[model samples]
Target: MAGRSFLLRVANVNPANVLTHTDRALYRSIGIFILLYGGYAIVGAASFVDASSNYTHPWWQWLVGPPVAAAVIAYDRAVVGRVAVNYEHLESADPHRLLRRRTAGLYTGRMVLALLFAIVITEPLMLARYKGEIDAYLGTVHNRELARLEQSGAIAAFQRQIDGLRAQDAADDAAVADLHRLAESKRSAATSAYNQALEDSRAAGVSRRAGCPPGGFCDALVQQSRSLNAEATRLDQEASTVRQAQEPARQSRATQFAALNEQIEAQRTSNRTTVESAAGFGARTAAMWELVQRDFWGFGFFYLGVAALLVCLDCAAVWLKLVSHGNGYERAEARDARRRELSELRRHQQELRVTEAATDVADAGLDTVVREQRLLDAAVSQATTRLLAELEEQTRTALTPTR
Candidate 1:
């Protein structure tokens, strides 16, 4: 019984005035509708925030839900409360009541607002209901976004740079290797000629020692050995110089290759992050629509049915009030309103009468004051005329005595 009363109060009903079972039941139903919508609004708002945000906290929805639900409930209450039950027979007879009659535009505006709220709340609930299908669709979206990112201009440019650097590095390595091989081959030839010359010098010395000759062949052979030894030393020095000269170039190529590879990796990481962040509400909505388009008869119809149900729920309070216009409670309410208006009008008329009496008394007092002032002015004028006449008579007596 207490709970029922509370619900009725939520529906803006005066519990004392609710006498009929129909009024009790209807107001209770409206209240229940309001409570249900509040709960749905909370859940829907939380789901909306969770779906839309990149970083979701467990308690964040609690923070979001209550405020949004409160606002929605307040709006619902206002919408319901604005729908005045105009029992036309009673209203038409009373001029004051006629002035308070709601217009068609008011009803239309309330319904429009209710419909908008229904759409706002329904979408998130629908998204939550078909989460699995939407998730699957989102998975496809994620993969597609990733693929698109891979083929994007920036990533492609990075890959091309990396490939070019690798090719240039390989070419540089091959050129350096060929130079080293050629230098080694020339050094080997110089070393071999020196070795042969040394052997010939030893043989020529042996011939000289055996008394065949003095300084001709042996000296020539020794000098050839010396020249070949100098050539080998020079070739080794040239090879060392070539290696020293190529070291900086080799290091530079290595640095360039490494830098380009790092850049490509960074770009790839950015692309992956971009794809990962595409799982927001807008993306999910698009995915859901795609699903609807694919399975229109199944999902689309279901979607429409759910939306209609929500819209009906949201507008129920107003519609109930509108339909239950000539009910007993409304009649009582209208009667009470008319009584209060009449009492107020009577009090205003009484005040007007009191004000008129006070005004009449003040006007009479003002007239008396004017009459007294006129009498006083007449008395003062008669006294002044009498004094002047006596002065004139005294002046005539004095003149006649002088004559």
Candidate 2:
């Protein structure tokens, strides 16, 4: 009694308790019959609810779950109360009439709830699915800007500027190498000329070759030696000038490369920061919209289908409640049905036993004693038939006497 009252308090005014499964043991026991009726729909709705609970979502996303569940219970109470009303009017205009204005509210509420449940269950996964869109959008912007800089020749020009400085430096090195080679060759030639001039002076000093005294040398040989010495001094001066000029150009090239490299690195770093800084929530939302447009025909349709199914199940839960009674009513229906079945079975069993008993009696020796009783019935029937014929003849004979 205590349990019943507790259930009643929680339940609507349904004496039948068809709307609330607070005591679901009744359904589980006689579930086969319910299954035969609308059990599939009942189970489908329940399984969907359970499955929704398992969807991957943050706790915050599921904030509405508890409230939605409360609403379902509340809706259950209202429906049960309606069922009670309908039950009360079983003989009146209200019996099983769910199309009435009062009853229609139940359906409407369920339809609305179905939409809510669908939203709650799928909303979290939906967000998770598209979370990458933000990063993708930002990354694209970064890459595109870099590509634009490349396309505008800014980066290439920077590279070329560095390469030109490097080339200038290399040219300076080649110029120094050529100067060294020239100096070596010039020194070798000057040494050969001096040696040859000294030999000519020796020959010039010979008395027979120069037509002069033994100690005297030719004057032209001395002049030629002086000129060759002057040429060697000029070559040395030229080599020193080239070396001095080469050092400055090389230093200038190194300075240019270092400064330009620093500028290029800073510019790249700044551009990267700008691209990242500009990507915000608005950009991500735009990306999300793009994803929706792209996938609406594919996976987006899948979400829609899921939502529709949830709605159907929501409505199905209510329909099952209104169309069928609770386990209490169903138990009675089952019991009564079982009783009829048992009665039929017992009747058939009784008839079979009676037939078997009759056969046994006929097979036994005592069965012959009833022959006189059987003959009595036949003899009575014959006598009645003869008396009827005799009466008809006597009537006809009396009519002839009057003639």
Candidate 3:
């Protein structure tokens, strides 16, 4: 009995208005369908949230389903509850036709809403049905997306810049090494020549000291050695200057290389993130479409079938209400509604009559008051005239007293 009452409430039917077992069963059926649709909505919403890449909180994602289900339940209850039967229509010659005509717009509107809800609820379930296939398909999609990003002009440009910087650094290093080698060769030759000149000068000093004077070949040889030493010193200074000049260039290239590498890495990370986050609703839908396109006869039929079933489930209560018109429960409900309306109308008439009677009584009292005031004014005027006449008579008698 409690369960029946709950189902009646779910069906938006008053238990007192249900007059037959068939009516009771019908309402229970409607309530069952409504509950079923609500359950389906919850499942669909949960699947939608779970499949989405945007919502990262797994625990919170499940929480989204209940509120959505509640909303759907509320809407369904309202739709079912508002479909009040017009009792007067039952009196018509063709009651069912009349009822349909009266509620056609309402039925159409509810069906349209049902269809919308069905689509919203159906797509996610369809995606879930083909979860494995869609997941695999999404893998391909992510790979393709990543590949596209990597091959994009921006990434290519970055790579080109990096390669160019590396090549320039390499060429600069090689050029600097060549310069060092050239300087070393020149310095070595100059050192060798300086040593040879010193030895020759020593030999000349030894030989000339025994046979000659002060200004001799020994002094010339010493001067040659000094010139060779100066050449070696100049070569060393030039090599140091070349190295100093190339050092700043190398450092600048290194800085540029580091910065470019960072940019390239950042771009790659962004591309990876984009590809990884592509498992969203839109992506899944697109993947589903691809599956449909690939095997239209097999997957497409199942997809449409699922959607049709859900739409039917969503519209079942409304459809039941639509068709079960002029039934015992609806007739009772209609009679109750009509009875209440007539009762209200009779009460309103009674109040209006009471108000009119009160108005008449007030008007009668006002007329009586007006008539009494008029009669009082006439009596006062008559008394004033009588008093004046008496005064006039006294005055005349006094005036005639002398006779």
Candidate 4:
């Protein structure tokens, strides 16, 4: 697919949905990139894991990787579920049928893919973030130990003694340097003087060879050359004096350096013993906490940077899901949920209809019971009236016969 087409997929959920053919391809590409990046992170994490464990004691001192892996994975799943719902709602007419279908392999596949990102990508970055924190933590630990030794006047006293020696050593070193400079100046002057004196002597000889009268220009020239020669000799003597003066300073420097070296070696030996006497990784790690605790800004920046990268991938995955108006799984689930709802509604309606029919039958039975009760009451009343009439007629007949 063209890069533009991929960009189109990335533009929005709508475009992602519209580009049906490219969705899977883009997803695969994105997945591969995420996996590769994550792999690189894992390699770094491996190194960090070993080193951190050595310093911190419990190897799991690298705490950032696992939880982050789990969280990222959970997020990926939630995204998938949401997208599935959207697909069913928007795209599928028969969502119920789709819902019944179980694609365990598909979900499992996604989870496996997400694992590559979570463990490899996110976990390693977390380790990367902690690298400086751990190092600083370790340094602080060592410093604190050193400080404790100083406070107790163990290493500190020794160091102080050495410090004094070192100070003298420094002074001697400086003096030696001055001496060397002086010696060099003297040597240069001596060489120049020697050359000048030699040249003057030669000139004086030439004047003598020219055979000028002893009391005239030759004599004056000879006197001038001798003066030059004496000046050169004085310069040479001065140069030798400077060299002799430098020797003492050089000797002092060597003596001071030897003493300083001896003191330093003693301090080194004591340090090794004290360090061995001290506690192990725990104390060191505790010291490291000082450094690690202060690196919040650094940690935050790394976290945000890694988060941004992962979030982009997350967004892309989400966008892919949003764009797919309906995937088979989504359609199936939506259809199934709908079917279940309709089935529940129909069952409720059936129950209501049965109840209504039973009510009607009861009402009819009630009416029949009422009619029978009324007929029974009327028969009883009519029978009593007829008996009373018969009795009265008999009484009147008997009375007439008696009159």
Best by lDDT: 3
lDDT (10s digit) by residue, model 4, range 1-403: 4654453333322333333455545545544443444444444345345444543435553455445544543454354444333223323464343433344565555656655655444544455455565555555555676667655554456566657766765765566566555655655565555454444445654333444456754555555555555555565566566557766865776676577667766766787566644433344334344443666465556565775676455445544554554654355455555666667777999999999999999999999999999999999999999999999999988888543
Q: What is the lDDT of candidate 1?
A: 0.73
**lDDT (0-100) at residue 125 of candidate 3?**
83
Candidate 3 residue-wise lDDT, 280-356, digit = tens? 87888898999999998878888988888888888898888777767877655666666676678779999999999
Question: Worst 10-residue stretch by lDDT in candidate 1?
Answer: 205-214
In order, what lDDT does every prediction score? 0.73, 0.55, 0.76, 0.54
**Which candidate comes out best when scored by TM-score?**
1
By lDDT, highest first, what's the ranking? 3, 1, 2, 4
Give the clashing residue pairs of candidate 4, or none. 17-323, 95-335, 95-336, 96-335, 96-336, 98-332, 98-333, 99-332, 99-333, 137-288
| Residue runs of model 2 more than 4 Å from their true location after superposition | 1-16, 19-96, 101-153, 171-177, 188-256, 273-403
TM-score of 4: 0.35
Q: In model 4, which range of ten residues has the least summed lDDT? A: 7-16
Estimated TM-score for each candidate? 0.70, 0.36, 0.69, 0.35
